[model samples]
Target: MYHTWMRFFTPGPAHHRLGLVCLGVGLQHGTLPTVGPRTLDHHVAVVVSTGRGWFRTPDGRRTAVTAPALLWLTPGVPHHYGPDPDTGWDEAFVDFTGPTADTYTELGYIEPHRPVVALSDAGAARATVGRIVRAARRGNPLLEVETSAAVHELLVTLRRARADTAPDGEQVLQALARDACKPLTVADHATRHGMTPAELRTAVRRGAGCSPKDYLLGIRLGHAKELLAATELPVAAVARRVGYDDPAYFSRLFTRRVGMAPVRFREQQAHTVPGGWSDQVPDPDDPPIIGRTPTG
Candidate 1:
């Protein structure tokens, strides 16, 4: 008494090397039959968009599943679930696996412990799955690559839609990014936000998946790379711009993290624009070249 549309794929080794591959995707509704208390080799993200159900782990603990909710069926984990017999439920699922899945799990994007996650909204996630569905079209040449990319987007969208996420943590991340180049210590930044240093670390770790110091360093070094590659600014000036008062320390830190000296990175990444380096970036809305027509 259920309607289901699903497609499974066997991606080539090259596609698997892309860090994530789509194993399958499906959309289902109505009073679907119960899923087994079986184990899987890969992972599946079962997004319940409507109605209700219950999920059971290997330990036989059953948790209520209400829309919009997400269920993570990780590798080697036994899972069992079914819709409420009377009401049924609408569900969309994407199965994926690759080396990067482990990294994503470590970063908290894929929660193995929290099997069933309540989501604030499933629209975005459903839309991403829709993209995968469209890519699943018969005779589509880009099916593997396109669907694989959508799986990455789906993971990010689901993480953002988690119901337990706090707005304050996001606000703190935004504030930290805005003041990333202010030369403030973690303690200083925490004080400005009316939070203790430990609290700041917790907030950043929850929000950005890293410590406050590491988050700030990531922002600072990213900007430094842009300046080094796009501008003719001296290394010292670039360091200062990114909040490193001591140029030598900045270079050392940059090398340690970036795996090469800044100068060497610049030499490898420097690009020459058609009109040469300009301090002002052109507005997207502005006409293509002052007097030239854009070509398709």
Candidate 2:
């Protein structure tokens, strides 16, 4: 036997005011919804909390949607997925749509084509979905605003989960942590790790969903930010601390990636936020941009 409940949000003009709209939220046990090959007009994420299932796409691809995994049905993308009849499954899911969806896709927060992803932090994923479910159930006046924030958190959680599970996930991350203050090329990075540049490229891309160059730039810029905010270091000194020897080139790169010159960033932060550091600190052991958004 199985039990289920779902809350479908009315897509009124009120919902569209937020960046993301929660179209529907659901929880089920011992059963899963039927998803035959078809396209949808909005994005839906069917996440399994327990048990297991399979997902099929339009081009005849199949994926095992195991426990703590997600089957993303993106808008206009043909897909199908459901639980195993014998074992069944426990699952929670949310359907959402907004401009942020496309932004997430572009940022690799959501893989529109890749349907199934095994989450590294199952507990966290489940917790986030639970929050979404609770918010939906509340049906408060701030429904759209609160649900949209929850959806953002869910997307970030999903991104971290997938990246943390990728092959060679920690190698490049560790290198960046240790060497963000040193000058190194992608080839040098690969060679030090006993991998070809191509292999390193793929692994880093799989783990972080960015090219090696972009990843390293993110690392350097993140480090540069801390120095700009906390230290009285000169612009050239700040650049050098983050591995750049040429201050002019470093300033240009920083301006491009961070949307402000190093000196300007420092002045702004110092003027406004007292000590000027954000409360959410980036974890030294985690990937770049963990706690901060890249302006670029």
Best by lDDT: 1
Give the lowest summed-lDDT range of ten residues in model 1. Answer: 272-281
Q: What is the lDDT of residue 237 in candidate 2?
A: 93
TM-score for each model: 0.89, 0.82
Please list the residue runs of candidate 1 whose C-alpha ends up more than 4 Å from where it truly belongs after superposition. 268-296
- The stretch of ten residues in a row with the least summed lDDT in candidate 2 is 270-279
Candidate 2 per-residue C-alpha lDDT over 54-123 given as tens digits, one digit per residue, 9 for 90 to 100: 8887878777777878788889888877789888898877899998798888777888767887776567
Considering only N, C-alpha and C atoms within 3 Å, which residue pairs clash in candidate 1? Answer: none
lDDT of 1 at 138: 93
